[model samples]
Structures are given as structure tokens and as C-alpha cells.
Target: MHPRPPCRSTHTFTIAGSRVAYDRWSGPGRPVLLLHALLFDRTQWWPLAADLAASCTVVAPDLPGHGESPMWTGCTPEQVAGVLARLVESLGLRRAPVVVGHATSAPLATAFADHFAVHGVVTVDEPVDLAGSGPAAVVAASGVDRVPERFRSFAEPREDPGLVAAYRSWLDRPSTLRPVPHARHPADDLNPPRFTPLSDPESLASRIQYLL
Candidate 1:
């Protein structure tokens, strides 16, 4: 599914005092909200969004301080989730959105589902229990350099030291999530096919469609 980049419209909206910059690609199905991992910005979801955009209205937002968004003042996961919920509400999707969160955004995704209206949620390469383990652990868990040389170039600038340090308290904070009615797609299996969202977005997009 290496297709051309779909048309997108960049937007800025304020929710809970945090002004967020998001990219929206129109579609007619249920909307899909794409949340990138730590360090990376909304561009990380560009390809995946394009694939999903044929059937889903895809919305990718620069998390707080990343990309074009301003710094986020919220500290706790619940607070951030609340802001995200408000942001999604502003989209006025015809149906509830299916939120796809990658890596560190997992907790925030679940938190959003815990208290908001979501059709479903998908988490890619989620680093479960890696929070508060420090930087070396973060790198080891991320395996960012193992990707194709071409993608590595895109993955580099995202590893900013200042941005990483600024979000330290984010990983350490106690996650405030309540278990939702969740049923795993085969993609959630222990021995499923190996794929990074960037490396195999079409397959991931298939999994998202199956989940829906």
C-alpha cells in the first residue's frame, strides 16, 4: 500500500488551553484519530493516514509541543486525555472515532477511551511497562535504528534530547486508566506477524479495519 500522499488540510484548534495543530484528510466512514509515539510528530502517521483515508476521515495532530503544536501545559495522563477528547469532539465525526495510538501514546489512548466516546482503539508497538525505566531502556525498547535506512532519516530528528527530557514526568506519572470492553484482533496476539507501523502500515491498517 505504498500510495501517494493523500490531500490534507492543516488545522489549529485550542482545547483546554492547549492549542493543537492537526492534519485532516476527509473520508466518509467513521473518523480515525492517529496519535504518534513520543518524539515523532503527526507526520509519522502520514502513510497510515493516507491508507485509512479512503474509508475513514483521518486526523493526525502534533502532540502538544511536537511539530506545529505549542507546548502542552497538562501533566497527568487523564488531563491530557480530557484535552484529546475535547479535540476529537470538535471534529464532529458522524460516528465515534477509532483512535490508533502508537508506542507511548498507548496510555493516553486508553485513557481517552476510558472516559470518552470511541468506536474502538488500536495501539501499535505499545511499550507496556517501560515507563519510568529511564532513557537507555527507552532506546532499547524503540529499536528505531533497525528500520530501513531511508526511514531512519525520518526517525532521526524526532529523537531530540530536549523534547525527551521535557516529557520525563509524563512517563513516570501514575497512569489513570480503567479497563474498557476490549477484545483483541489477531494483531494483538503474542506471536502475530512482525511489523512496525511505518514499515507495514497497510497491514496495520488492515488490522484497524478488522477491529472496526
Candidate 2:
């Protein structure tokens, strides 16, 4: 087995009036851009970014409205995709970097691939059908946010105090959390790993290496 690569130094940058937070584990080559899920940030790729960086430059950007990126008003997948495209151009990527998107961001990645040229695209465990419907529609139709209300309706009989407290804090501070609706049914938002192209870290790294 290959040894794990060392984590590269992290950095942050701003573009389009938004703070584009990223971690540059390596540099000066085809940049692998990672777009995380709505509920997550750029750090989600921590499991694999460094390993990929060893072979090619890796740049994972927290899409606007998530992580350190300033939330934009009326942000849509298409708009998010446009911003990412611009980011690639601004950075002067040597080659169209491969984009790896997770969960909800997968659709945004698809939109990017459809509109912009890229070395390759990898979307992991994303609910593409759900994403294609858009968050607003999901909220309106399901009476909850992005995920259907059925998904988030269950009450925890025994909850971890820490998690409960953290959630409470998140709810108290509206700015801390994205104001998306909850899913009514958990399965509606959850996709099986088998359906995705990259379900595990090894497969994901292989795909990224191929793109690089």
C-alpha cells in the first residue's frame, strides 16, 4: 500500500466579492478543485486531498454560501458553477482541472462540466435527482428545505449532549447555518454508494489521479 502524503499548507483567497476559502496542498500543476456538499466545507476532502496533491496540485474551494465563502444573495447551482468557472480562469489553471463535487454540489459540478471544459469530473454520493430539482422546489413541495421533511422529522430518543448543544447553537445563530429546508424523508436525500462513480477513498484518489 502507498503511504499517505503529507498535508500541504492551507490558504484562502477572495473572488467575486466572496471569500473563496481553499487549502492548497500542492502547487504549479493542474489544480484539482473540490466542491463540497451543502452541509460541509472544503475540509471534507481532508481524507484524500493530500494524497492527490502528491501527484498533482490540489485546490479545494468552499463554494460561496458555504464554509468561509461569503454567502451570496439568491445563490443557485448555475450561478455557483459560473463562479467556479471564473475561479479556474482567474487562477490561470494550466489545464482544465478535474472537479470533484460531493453530495449536493455534484449537480453544480455537472453544470460546470456541461458548460466549461474540464479534464474530468467526479461526483461522489450525490443525490443528483434531488439536486436537479433545486432547493427551492424541494422546500416548497415537501414543506421543508432542500432535503424532504420526512428525512429530518425523526426525534432523537437519546441524543448526544454535545451534538444537541451544537445544533441548538446553530439554530440560535441564523448566520452560522445555511437557511435550507430539512428533508422529510431521509432516503429521499441519501444515495447508495454503489450508484456513484467514486464511493470510497481509494477509488476517488484513482479518479483524481486520472484527471490530473
Candidate number achieving the greatest TM-score relative to the actual structure: 1
lDDT of 2 by residue, 1-212 (tens): 22224555556665556556676766557878777655445655665665576677777777665566766653556666777777777766558878776655555666677788777776655443442343343223222233223223211112234322322222222111112221112452453433122124556687567656
TM-scores for all predictions: 0.82, 0.63
Model 1, 49-143: lDDT tens digits are 77887787888888877889877766455776777777777888657888887767777788778788888887766654565565555544444
Per-model CA lDDT versus the true structure: 0.69, 0.53
- RMSD versus native structure for model 1: 3.1
Model 2: residue 40 alpha-carbon error in angstroms = 0.8
lDDT of 2 at 75: 51
How badly does each model clash, as a count of residue pairs?
A: 0, 13
Error of 2 at 187 (Å): 18
